[model samples]
Target: MNKPVILCVDDEVMILDCLKRQLKTEFRNTYVYELAENADEAMILIEELEKNKSEILVIISDWLMPGIKGDEFLIGVHQKFPDIIKILLTGQADEKAIRRANTQANMYCHLCKPWSATELIETIKSGLKTISKS
Candidate 1:
């Protein structure tokens, strides 16, 4: 099997770059990280990973994007790949959005914008632990 993978989605290029840097620095050998600018690309990556027999252990997505809200994207992912841990990282998602995601997407957690790198790493580690056990 391929190495564990983490898929991160955001419309902003800067955020994706930051996440890639942090993940690479913190868990250099533990994960193969992938990034997408939108949900469509993310879905394509997911399909490719599935075909390649690669386990997508975690997915972190933004809530307020140009199109296809994070909740909607996550719900789609949950329907097709429920085993992937879903996390929301957004600054503007309301409580109702979060509730909807929790119900439909089975969201693992929500981390607000301006999140500390240490906290993100901890969450990633916790998610990996859950996947490893499964």
Candidate 2:
């Protein structure tokens, strides 16, 4: 059986690397972690995972990117796959953007950049709890 996926998108390579490392340390074999540098690439990865019959359980995305912003990207993802938990991990997103994500994307949580490992893991755990209840 294909393991559920946790996708993270960010423009900065270092940020993506850090997220991947932290998630891998915490989650290990629990979920397949996928990283994308932009929204377009993330969409492609999502489609491919779906094609392979993989369930995407969570998505953690940065708010600023070259093409699609995080709020818009999560909203798009929600439109296609409403059950996938969305989390915005950004350093500079405004209130309007975060609000939009909460209402439109059904975002589970918002974690600012420089987030602690405990905070990120706790948020993911809470999100997984919601998914389990649903």
Candidate 3:
């Protein structure tokens, strides 16, 4: 069986690298990690994964991107893949955007930039627990 996937999207390559390293260290072989630079690319990956019968268990996305804001991107993702857990990561997102994401995307959590690795892992763990239950 294909391993469940954790997809992270951020315009900044450095942030994506950091997230990948942290998630890899914590999750190891338990989940597959995928990275995309923007929402458009992420959507392509999501489609491909679905076509391959791979379950995308979670998405961690940055709020500030070139074309699509994180909230909008996540909302679109939720509309199509409602079961995938959505997480927002941002340093500059306004309250309204965050609230909208919570309401529209069923967002699991919002983590700020310069986030603690421990906290990020804990959040993912909590999300994973909820996923397991459902």
lDDT of model 1 at position 18:
97
Give the alpha carbon lDDT tens digit for every residue of 47-114 in model 2: 99999999999999999999999999999999999999899999999999999999999999999988
Instruction: Select the stronger candidate by lDDT from 1 and 3.
Output: 3
Write the residue-wise lDDT of candidate 1 on 7-44 in tens digits: 99999999999999999999898889999999999999
> Candidate 2, clashing residue pairs?
none
Q: Against the correct fold, how does model 2 do in TM-score?
A: 0.98
State the lDDT of candidate 3 residue by residue for 56-92, as single tens digits: 9999999999999999999999999999989998999
lDDT of 2: 0.96
Ranking by TM-score: 3, 2, 1
TM-scores for every predicted model: 0.95, 0.98, 0.98
When sorted by lDDT, best at the front, the candidate numbers are 2, 3, 1
lDDT of model 1 at position 105: 94
Per-candidate local distance difference test = 0.93, 0.96, 0.95
Residue 134 accuracy (lDDT) in model 2:
77
- Candidate 1 Cα outliers beyond 4 Å, as residue runs: none
